[model samples]
Target: MSLVYSTETGRITPEKEQAQRPKGDGIVRIQRETKGRKGKGVCIVTGLDLDDKALKLVAAALKKVCGCGGAVKNGTIEIQGDNRDKIKDYLVKQGHTVKFSGG
Candidate 1:
């Protein structure tokens, strides 16, 4: 066991992050979450094995395709709206294994 969080910086280093994501058979899961959004919806994309920079790049492409505003936080990509099907197709065409969850 080793310390991943740097007390001086008050954050976890890249190598030891990603502890929040639950992993399984290696497929990305895109789900629509509206629980805390005041009735609006946002697509939560998870299970991507990408570092911050790479994830941002992918998020940019998805945002372009969806034509909406979003952000990447805590290793997950949040796209604005219920664009799960569209995103699934785009990711498949881009060679990423993906799955959809939620309504």
Candidate 2:
């Protein structure tokens, strides 16, 4: 076992690493969530089996298509506003199996 504190290094601690997202089941699901962010609705895209860089690229393309500002958090892409239909169309064009998860 390693000591939590070290006299020579002051407070010894491990470096924080980026969270690793689990692999998806091939099917992609898109849902809308507004629990946080003061009631602003965001489309949550999940089940994309892509790495962080690729995920960001996909998110950028989605944002461009929807003409909105959004972000990639964890393994999901959150697009601003209610753009389900537009997102679905784009994903379909990209040859992805997309489905609306929540109502």
Q: Show the lowest summed lDDT stretch of 10 residues, model 2.
A: 14-23
> Compared with the true structure, what per-residue lDDT tens digits does model 2 show for residues 1-103?
8678888879878778877777788999999998977999999999999988999999999999999999999889999999999999999999999999988
Off by over 4 Å in 2: 1-18
TM-score of 2: 0.81
CA shift at 22, candidate 2, in angstroms?
A: 2.0
Q: lDDT (CA) for every model shown?
A: 0.89, 0.93
**Model 1 misses residue 77 by how many Å?**
0.2
Q: Pull out the clashing pairs in model 1.
A: none
Model 1 scores a TM of 0.77
lDDT of 1 by residue, 14-99 (tens): 56454555544678899999998999999999988887899999999999999999999988999999899889999999888999
Q: Give the TM-score of each candidate.
A: 0.77, 0.81
Model 1 local distance difference test score:
0.89
Estimate candidate 2's RMSD in Å.
3.3
Stretches of model 1 off by over 4 angstroms after superposition: 1-24
Q: What is residue 17's positional error in candidate 2, in angstroms?
A: 7.2
